[model samples]
Target: MKKHLLLLSAAAAALLAEEATLAPVSVVATGVEESVVEQPEAIAIKEKPEIELDQVVFQKDLFNSLPGVRIEQTGSVFGHMTAIRMPINTGPYYLFMQDGIPVQSSGFFNHNGLAYTTFGTAESVEVLKGAGTALYGSDAVAAVIDVHSTPAPSEKRTFLFKGTGGMYGYGSGLLEASGPAGEEGGYFANVHYLHSDGWRDHTQADRLEANGRYDLAIGDANALKIILNASKTEAQQADSFNDYANITDRSKAASDDPNYFKALEYVDVKRKFDYARLSLEWSNFSFENLDIVTTPYLRYNRNRYIATWQPNLPANDNELTTLGLLQRNTYQADWGRVIFGFDTEYTRSSLTYDQKFDIQTSGWSAAYYQAGTIYDYDVDYFAIAPYAHLEWNMSDKVVFSAGLRYDYNKFDYTNNLEDDSYYYALTSKGQKAIYYRPGDRTDSFNHVSPKASLSFMPDATTNLYIRYANGFRIPQASRLYSMKAGYETVTLDPETSDTYEIGLKKFFARHTFVDLAAYYMNIDDTITRYKNDNGDYYYANGGSSIHEGVEVGAGYAFNPSWRFKIAYAYGYHRYDNDPKYGDNEMAQAPNHTGNIRLFWTPWQFPGFELMAEYIYVGSWWFDDDHEAGKYKGYQLGNLKASYRYDDHLKLFAKIDNVTDNEYAVMARYAYGKTDYTPGDPALAYLGVEYRW
Candidate 1:
C-alpha cells in the first residue's frame, strides 16, 4: 500500500507541472463625450461588503456552526476524532455525495459500528439536523451528515497531499489529484490510509479508502460525471463496559476487576464497504430570466462484516453481507424542483455459537464435553420508493417549500438448518414469523410523509423562518425476521414524528453573525428495544416521546487577523405516553452542550495561523431509571497551528485533549447497573500538505 501510494503521488505531481502565465493588458480611452451633473446628492449609500450565502459558516462549517452537531473521538482509524456519537453499538451513517449524488449503503441498521471512511478529500460537511427521510431515504432518524468532494479546479492540473502521526500509535496519510484529461474532460482521484492504537485497552484499528471520479463536458450546458469509492476497515471492538463500582469508587479493586477493560476478553471485528455512482447532468443557460437543471443518477453499495470471539461458547463467529442499488432523477426550474427515486437491497447473515462443559465421574475420573452450533441464513429485500419535492416563492419576501414521499418494500428469507422441524415449530408461535413461509413471504407498506417551510426576509440583516416536517423509518430485515428462537420479531408500526421549528438570523457590520432556533418534536410510534423474560431482546412500539430544544450560535471578527465563534444548545427529551416510563429522560442524548473557538494570526508572522477550541458536553442519562444520576459532564480542549511555506506547500499540527482529562460520553447496562466507558484522553499529530 505504501508503494502504491507513493507512485500515485509522483504521477499527480508530474501532471501538475505545467504552469499558467498571463500577459499584461492596457486600456485606452475612446472618443466619447461624458456629461457630469452635480446636485444636492443627499442620499448616503451605505458601504457594504459583498455577502455570499455559500460562504456563511452555517452552510459550510459542520463542526463550528451547525446546531446539534457533535464530533467525538472514537478509537477507530487515525486516532483522530470522528463525527460520530456516544453509543458504541450504534453506527453513525453519514451520507457521501459527489455534486448531490448519494453514495452510501442503504442497510442503515445492522452495519458495523467502527467503519469511518471519508477523510482528507471532502471540501465541506453539511450536518442537517433532525430526521432526513424527506431528502434521503430510510434510516435517517437522528440526522443527515453529507460529505461533498471538491469539484475540479478550472486550472489545467492540481495536486494535493497530507500526512500526520501522534501518540497512542496514531498515523494517517492522504493523496488527491484533479486535472484536465483532454479538450473537454477532466479526472480526479483521492486515496487515504489511517491506523491507530487507541488510548483505551483492546481498541486498535486501521482503515484504507480510495475514490476516483471523471467528468466530461459534452456541450456548453451538459456534463456527465461518474464516481467510484471503496473503503476497508479492521478493528478490535470497543463496546466493552467498565464496572460501575470501579468508576464510582476509584479504588484498586475497580482497576483489578476483569470486566474493567476490553483486553480481558478477546474480541475482533472487520468490515469492508464500497460504493459507486454514475450521474448525467444537463443545464440550460441560453434562455433569459430563467434557469433549468436536470439530473439522472444510479448508485450501488456493498457492506460486509466479520467477527471472531475467544473464550466464548463455540468460539463465537459471525458474518453479514448487504448489497444495495438505487436510481434517481431530479429536475429544477424557475418555479420549483422535482425529484423521483427508487431503491432495492439484498442481505445475507451467518452466526455460530459454541460452548464447552465439564463433567465429573462418580469417584473415578473427570470428563469434559464440547458442543458447537451454527446458524446460516440469507435474506433478499426489494423496495421501490417514488418521492417528490417542490418549492415556490409566494412573494418577494415569503417563500414556501413542500415535499411528499411514498415507499413500498418486500423481503424474502432463506435458511439452512439441520433441524427444519424445530424452525417450523418456532415460527408458528411468533407474530413476525407469518412473513416467513416455506417459500418467499412478501409484505409491503405505503407511507405518505409531508414537509412544509416558510421564510420571511423583512430586511437585509434580519430573517425569520418556520418549518414543519413528518418523518418515518421502516424496520430492517434483521429486526423484522430472525431465525433464532429468542429473536422473535415484533409487530412494529411505522415510527413517525412531527417537528416544528422557528429560526431567527441577524447580520451586523458584515463581520458579525448570529442565529437562534427553537424546535419541538412529537413522536407517535417510537420503537424501543428491551430484554424479555428469557433474556431475549425484542423491539416494540408502544409509547410516545416529546423533544424540545433551543440553539444559539454567533461569530465575531475583531479584524482580518482575529475571529471568535461560540455556540450553545439545550435539549429536553422525555417519554410522553408510557405511564411506567413517562417522565424519564431519553438515553444517550445530552441535555446541554456548547463550544467555543478562537482563531488568530500574528501581524509579524505573515503566513502563520493558530486556533484554540473548547467543547463541553453536559450530563446525560443512560437508562430510564434516573437512579444512575448522570454520566458526569466533560470538557475538552484542542489546539491547531499551520504555516504556509509557499503557495504549494503547507505544514500543520493538531493537539487534541490538551489537558488529558478522563471522562465518559456513553454507558452500557451491565451487572444490574450502567457502566461508563471513558473517552480518549490525549493525542497529537503533525502533517504537511502540497497543493498546486
Candidate 2:
C-alpha cells in the first residue's frame, strides 16, 4: 500500500514549465508588481488561459492544481474548507482578496467566505503559501489568495459567448464583452449563470454573477480604475451519511438512512447568499523617484442558511456592509526600494438565529430544542493598520527584505436579547445544552507582525530563498459575542503563527522548472471550545499547535507537443501543548496530497489539445482524540479535450472520475458513528464557445 501511494505521488505530474516562466508577474508578495523569481516568497500562479482550459464548474476547484493547497468540498455549493500550510479544519486562517483588496472584513471572517467573491472574469489567481508578509495583516495566517480581474482592453474590441451542459441536469452560460470606451478609457464586462440539479437527492444549486471594470488613462502619469461585481447563489445543503450503501449508491440523504434519527433529517436544509462590491482605484501617479496609489471600496454580503449540521436545524441569518480604503506609496532608487501603506475599514453587521420548529427524540441519538429565537445581535467593527516594507540589494546576486505592521481592531457589540439571557436544550447524550446572551460591550485588540527574508540568485536560472513571517487572526464577532454556559466573559486573544521557510528554484536547460520549499509553523493562542469539569462547553484561547511540511512542483516539456507536470506535498500537524489530545495528529490533516497531469497538443492538427490528470488524497485520522480510526483517502482521474474548429468556434469535452470509482469526498467519525460525504460518480461535460 505504501509503495502504491508513493507511485501515485510520483505519477501526478506538474503544471507546464512554460506556464511557470512565461508572463511571470506576482503582486501578492508585496503590494506592488514583481517577478515570481525575484520575490522572496513561495507563490503559485494560474494564468487566464490555463483557467479557461479547465472550464471549472465549481469555484472550490480553482486552486487544486497548485502544491500544498486543498479546498475540500462540503456539499454547500460554492462553499469549501481550505487547507494551505495548516490543518484541514475550517478556521479563520486564510485571507481572500480580489484585485489586491479584501473581499470581507477580518472581524466577520467566515470559513466559507470564498462564495462571497466572483472569479468569472479573473485574469489570474495567485496564492502565497505559508504565513503572509506585513502587507497582509489579520486572517493571513495560513495563506493569502488574490484573484486579479481582467483589465479593460486598450487595443481592440472582443466578445465571447459560451454554453455548457452535462449529466445531472447541469447547465451554464457565460457572456463577455470588452472594448475601448474612448481615447483615454476602456471597459470590460462579463456575466455567468449556472444551475445544477445535483447528483444527490437534495443538492440542487444555482448561481448568477456579473463582473465589470473600467479604466481611464489620466494624462500620462496616473490612471483611474473602477471595479464592480455582484453575485447571488442558492443551494440545498446535503448531509453526510454513515451507511455504506448510501455512499456507494450516490442517491441518498440523511433522511433516507434507516439508522438515522428521523427528527435529525435535513432534507430541506438550504442556503441563500448575495454579495456586491464596488471600488475606485487611483494609481500610477509618479513624482521624482516616488509612486502612489489609493483605493476606496464598499462591499455588502448577506447569507441565510439552515444549520442542518446542528441539532434541531436552526436558521442562521447574517449580513454586513463595509467601507474600506487602501493607500500605498513607494520610493525607488538604484538599491531596492521602500513601501509605506495603511489600511482602514469600518463594518456594520447583524446576525440572528432562530429555531422554526421544536423537536425531541429518545435513544442514543436523543435531541431536543425549543422553537424560538435564540440569538440576535448587531456589531460595529473598526480597524486600522499602518505598515512599511524595505528591500535592499546586497549584491547583484542577493536581495534582502523586511517589513512590519501594527494593527488596531475594535468591535462594539449589542445583543438584542436581554442581558444575561439563557436558552436551554438537550444534547445527543441527554445532557443540558446551554446558550447565553451577553450585554452590549466594546472590545479592542492590537498586534504587531514582522517579516524578513533573504534571497540569492546564484544564476539567472537558479534561485534560493529563506524567510520568516508572522500572521494572526483576530477573534471574529461570533467568537466574542456568541456565548455559552460558563463562558460569559470570553477574553480571547488574537491567534498568531510564526513560520520559517527555505525554498529552491531551478530551471533545467530551459525546458524544466522545479520549485521546492520546506516550512515550519508554530501557532499560539488557538481559539477553541473545551468542555469544563461540569460538562459544559466554553470558548477560549488556550490551545497551541505545530505544523511542518514540504512541497514540490516541477514540470517538463519533452517537446512542443507533449508535457508532464507534478505537484506534491507532505505535511505533519500536531498538538503542541493542549489539555486534551496531547501530541495527537490534528484531525483531517492529510499527510500526503499530489496531482499529476500530461498534456498533448498535436502539431499536425493545430488547435487540438488533450490533457489527462490524476489526483490523490492521503489518509488521516478522523478525530482529534485519535480514537475513531483513520480514513484512507481516495484517488481520481480526469480527462479533457478541446478542439478549436475555427477562429470563431471551439468545442470541448471533459470526463471526471474516469475510473468510475466509489469514494467519499469527506469522511469522519463522531458520536460513535461514521459519516461519509460521497463524491460524485463518473460524469461528463460538453461545451462550446464563440468569440469575435
- Which candidate should be chosen as best, given lDDT against the real structure? 2
Candidate 1 local distance difference test against the native: 0.51
Query: Local distance difference test, per candidate?
Result: 0.51, 0.81
Model 2, span 1-692: residue lDDT tens: 01111111111112222444533667898877655777878898777666777778875457887899888777766767788988776678999988888888998887777777786556789999988888888999989999876654534688999999998899999999887777767778899999999877667999998888887766667777789988899998777776768767766564443423443353357888889999998876558777788999999989888765554567889999999999998888899999999999999999998876776743344567778888999999999999999999999999899999999999999999988888777765565646888889999999999999999998766779999999999998888877776677668899989999999977674337888999999999888656566534466886798999999988899999999878899999988888776778888889999999898999999999898999999998877778888888889998988999899999998998999888877777654467777787888999999999
TM agreement with the true structure for every prediction: 0.76, 0.93
Report the C-alpha displacement of residue 616, candidate 1, in angstroms.
0.5
Q: Write the per-residue lDDT of candidate 1 for residues 1-692, one digit (tens) a residue.
A: 01111112324323432210111011000001010000000000001001111111111123433455655433222222222212222432333334454444333353332133243445444444554534555644444544545444333687888777777787878888887777666778888887877655555666777777776655554455566655556555443244555434422221232322322233233334444445554443344433344455554444443221121212333344444444444455666444455555444444333332221111111122223233444555555566666557677666676767666655565654443312211212232211121223444555677777776766545557777767666665555544345443446666676767787766564346676777787777676665455433446775887778877767788998998777787888777776456667766667888888787878788778787878888877766656666576778897778888889987777776689776665564533445565555566778777887
- Residue 355, candidate 1: C-alpha displacement in angstroms: 8.4
Model 1 poorest ten-residue lDDT run = 35-44
